[model samples]
Target: MRGLKKEARLPTVYEVIGVLILFIVIMFGFINLLELPIQLALFTSWFMVIGLGLWIGLRYKKLQDGLLQGISNGLEAVLILITVGALIGTWIAGGIVPSIIYYGLSVISPNIFLFATLIICALTSLATGTSFGTAGTAGIAMIGIGQSFGIPLPLVAGAVISGAYVGDKLSPLSDTTVMTASLTKVDIIEHIKSMLYVSGPAFGIASLLFIFVGFFYVGNSVDLTRAEEAMGALQGQFNISWYMLVPPLIVIALLAMKQPSIPTITFGAFLGVIWGFAFQGIPFLDAIQTSYQGYSIDSGIEFMDTLLNSGGMVSMLEVILLILLALGLGGLMEAAGILHVICQTLLKWADNAGKTTLTTLIAAFFGNFFGGAAYVSVITGSKITEENYDRLNIDKRVLSRNTEAGGTITTPMVPWSDGGVFMAVTLGVSTMAYLPFLWFHFLVIIITLLYGFTGKFIWYTKGKEYTENYEDSTVNTTKFEA
Candidate 1:
């Protein structure tokens, strides 16, 4: 018993692969063919992973520790989810959301709406270094505005996601941005420049595509009756003044000051509660209640009421549950040496810089797929591939860039991921619905892949110095040792 306790069994590659194949099939089948909630699939998968852990000679206690550690990786995101929910609910009751909608309907041209939504969200996330805030605030308003113009909500959501993610990727204040930089041992500025090399063109391409697609929706906006009615209802219900913007401004200011996200967002939520009482003439108790249960109204205008009635602490319960289960499943996989076995199998094929980069990306992606958090994914990807990168003489910054491209940018596409679940729940658009239209993310990932194969942005480091070969841009890591 003591000998067994001292060391856990390592599962063979065959065991891990068989379990993974089963997990993927069931996960997709539950989500697609059965049309069941993802929570059920995640719940079911947790048990299967636990069985694997026990079968591989790992103790239940060790597996539980892995689960807790995985959940800890997302503890920040969990708090943000809860806080943002209350912020949304109270912001609506306080007239903050409506003000944006009221003014958005007044000035935003339908012809340029999609293009405009992308840019507005991009800038907001860029400044605040938060996609959740950008989407929950400006993205919400963009949805209402786009719907008023008769545009499909999914298209608008795609634009919002593209803009939000792009800005978050490049923002100096973003946690993922800094994490990816530090793990690769690269200067943050150099890391940002390397990402810009790929993301910049992807953004330009996405912008052009949005601009072109914006014209197609021109017919939808020709009749502004919905817009006119929404504006009128917004004005009748709330003050619709500039002061509504103050809450978000304060949240942004706090974030700018490098305050942690949890308290900053919570402060914004309570501020909304105060505004609901002061400006909307609601009783203090009722306003606070809205923060817990979400805002509600019988405004006679169906769409206006639907648009405005959202956000609350309770509304985030399901998302929180998903996070817990997903992280638990990730923990089980990690503790049983399942992910390590798979990553090693994947690394065997990484013979060249391009292949190594691509393999590193797939590993990062699988980290999100199985690890269930960006922090773990980025760290796991960087650590697993660091040795291969050193052996191949490729710069680790490129590895870091690939990590973000796969780990962070592509996170919102995975339904079980924290980012994916949050975006889907917040924007009222399913991840699958908006996924096809995430032009920027898709473009950036594709560009990163191309760079790996064609050696477009692949950089080589010399010896142990980690300095780039500035004079010889064509220095090839694939041939560095050959």
Candidate 2:
């Protein structure tokens, strides 16, 4: 478990091939047969896949060390997930989430619902550095509002999630973004800037799609009935004042000043708890309940209770579980060198920059086929393509761009991936239901491939400049050589 031994290691090729086969069987049982609940199926598959890895690692007496190494390697991500849970709990108790929901609902207009969903979710995601948080806090409210307006639910959720993921993918404060950059040894700003080539077009196209979709939203006769009722209910439950906005504002301010994510989120959560107690005069028990079990208030409206009563550490458990399971699967794959094998196999198809870029995109796309998260895909794909990019004289920027485009940005479209599952659950929509409306992800994938085909985005430098820019700086450690 501590590390790979010299003689007992399995070949990367077999490891990757086995992983692919295992996932295919799992996907078949879940998606085609519909044999179990999605969550259960996911958990079961993750366990089975990891069990296989453990079995292979256990062939030698050193298996215990390998297991410990695997778990230890995952410690950072586990801490991040735990902090995320705490952050969600505190945000709800603090009134920051409620405030955002209140204001977000106030701005709703049928004429601009789609674009508005995008903008609001994007801002929320940027603030929280979490698409899941944005979706749970604002996406649900938008969905309810959209339903009230007689707009299509899936399309609204799609626009909202697309925008949310955009911010989540780009924000320096995002855990996934930070993890990707750290794992790849790229500066966060450089990685973000590099993504602009792909993400920019995707965002624009998604916005345009939302605009077009908005036109189809035929106004629902302006339903102030529900809105008024919900607002009144909200006011009755909490001290509805401007002051409730301070904590979230401060969190954003801290992020702008380049504070670290765990601390920043923890700070926001702490202030949220304070707001819950001070303004609402919630009892200590109630404060604890609200932070962990969520708040419950009767506001003379059933829907309002359902909406406001949502929060707590408990609300985020599903997502937190998903993260743990998905990351566990990823850890096993890393331990088995499955990722390296997959990368090696794919690199053989790249004969030119165009092919190399396409191959990278394909590798990323296939990553979700194994049911992990976007950060896993991006890091794995980036490492896989680094050597190929250098050999083909492609810039590292190009490699980074493709990885973000096909791996990071597109994860939410795959139902098995962490981002996808989280978004669907948060918005109360199915992944397939919103697939057509996720124009941003599609656009990014398309633009990246198009650039590859046209050779427009490809840069080949000769002499010191090319050597300096295109040379691979990727660190190598597939086996536990040490």
Please report the candidate that would top TM-score against the real structure: 1
Q: Which stretches of candidate 1 lie over 4 Å from their true place?
A: 1-7, 218-222, 463-482
TM-score of each: 0.93, 0.82
lDDT of each model, Cα atoms only? Answer: 0.84, 0.67
Tens-digit per-residue lDDT, 1-482, candidate 2: 65744343444566557667777777678867977655566667655655555554434224334434444544554454445455555555656555655665576667787898898888877776777656755676677666545566788888888888887778877777776676556788987887777787878888877877676544534465666666655566666667877876686677666677567666666677787778778765667556567666666776555545665667667766665555555555555556656666777778887788887877776555453567567766676677777676676777877777767777877775777766775566788999888887788888888889898767764663323332233323333322
Report residue 272 deviation for candidate 2 (angstroms). 2.2
What lDDT would candidate 1 get against the real structure? 0.84
Stretches of model 2 off by over 4 angstroms after superposition: 1-19, 30-34, 38-96, 124-133, 136-150, 172-190, 218-224, 365-371, 465-482
- In the range 51-93, model 1's lDDT, one tens digit per residue, is 8777756678877888888888888888999999999999999
Question: Clash pairs of candidate 1?
Answer: none
